[model samples]
Target: MKQKMIDVSIHLFDKKGFTETSIQEIVDELGVTKGTFYYYFTNKQELLTTIHLNFIEFLLKKQEEILQDEAKDSREKLRAMIYMVLQSINERKKSARIFFREMRNLGPKYLEQNVEKRDQFRKNLQQLVEEGIHKGEFQEDLHADMVTRGILGMTNWSYYWYNPEGDVSAEELTDIYVEILLNGINKSD
Candidate 1:
């Protein structure tokens, strides 16, 4: 029942902005009563917070697992991380939309918690870039932090415009992105 409400709410929140989505609408969509919602969640905000936490925590766990694999080089780890994110976007399209778009609607405490997790994710990527540079795989002249942010920006922005059913598959898009990141698009002299 709790997961049902969350799934329905993610669809609603994705289709309609969080501020615009009402408890009544969610309940109606789920064909459940207000008492049932209240039994599980204290209020709409609580539900939103739960959604935000679940989304980030799931991604974070996956990121940590990828980082822990010693057999893969830094480059492979980076590719796997980007692929994981793109795969998540494809699999949980609505939830990804809601996670990125409606995060600001969370209360102060929830917002802070989510932000911490997000920052940690970014830091892990930054560390990967640093490792690549240290190992002489990536250009030593590159700025690790800035490059990390750029990589994340390129992948995360896909949530807004990427169509899972489009001609370009997620794996293809990841290849393009990873190529651009590893090799500049500019023609060599």
Candidate 2:
């Protein structure tokens, strides 16, 4: 029942802005009474917070798993992380859209927790970049912080325009991004 409300709310929040979506709409979509929603979530903002947490937590867990793998180099881990996000776009497109687009609607307490998780994701990636540089896998002169942000900007923006069902598979897009990151597009004469 709780999951049903969340799934319905995600669709509603995606189609209608978070501020524009009402509790009644969610319950009506689920064909349940408002009491059922209140039983699981205190209010709409709490539900949104849960949605945000669920998305980021899944990402954090995947990142942690990739980071812990001993066989993969930093470059391989980076590719895995990128592919994980892109694949999520394929599997959870509506959730991704809502996660990115509806963030501003979160209340202060909710926003704080969400921002903390987001920061953790960025910091973890930055650490990966720093590790790559230390191991000579990446350029020594590169700015780890900037590189992390660049990776995130390149991937996260895809929710707005990337077509998971289009000609480019997530694996192919991952390859393209990894190629661009590891080797720039300039032609060498």
Candidate 3:
């Protein structure tokens, strides 16, 4: 039931702008009463908040799984994180779009709360960059926070244009991104 609501929110928000999607529209689509909607969410904003928090929580949990895998070395961990992101985007692709792209209508209060989760994701990436640099796998002077933003900027931007019907599989896409991440644009020996 919770997942159903999340799905409805994603579909409705994607098809229509967040500011334009009303609770009645969602209720009508779900064939549920206003009271039913209220039970799961106080209002549209609350439902949006739930969706945002759930996505961030899901991402953090998966990241924990990859980062805590001691069987892998630092570079492997970094690669795993990148792969995990692609996998997550593939699985939760629609919800991710709603969580990331549609949350501005959530107002500053809710958005501020959600920012903590965003910051945690950044911190996780920053730590990985720092670790990679420590091991001489990445630029030693790599600005961990800056690199974190760069990696996120590159990966998250895919949501705007990534296609399930596209030529590259998600794994292939992850590999492509990783190669560029590790080797960068400069030619090497």
User: Measured by TM-score, how close is model 2 to the native structure?
Assistant: 0.97
Residue 38 CA displacement from its true place in model 1, Å: 1.4
Candidate 3: which pairs clash? Answer: none
lDDT of 2 by residue, 81-168 (tens): 9999888765888888888988888879789999999999999999999999999999999988999999999899888899967899
Model 3 scores a C-alpha lDDT of: 0.83
- The reply for model 1, stretches above 4 Å from the true place, is none
CA lDDT of every candidate: 0.89, 0.90, 0.83
Superior by TM-score: candidate 2 or candidate 3: 2
Relative to the unseen true structure, what is the C-alpha lDDT of residue 63 in candidate 2, on a scale of 0 to 100? 91
Model 2 Cα RMSD, 1 decimal: 0.9
Give lDDT for model 1. Answer: 0.89
Return the candidate ranking by TM-score, descending: 2, 1, 3
lDDT of 1 by residue, 1-189 (tens): 999999889888888889999999989988888999999999888999889888888899999999999999998998999999989877877878888888888978678988999899999999999999999999999888999999999988988898869899988988998998888799999
Candidate 1 weakest lDDT stretch, 10 residues: 89-98
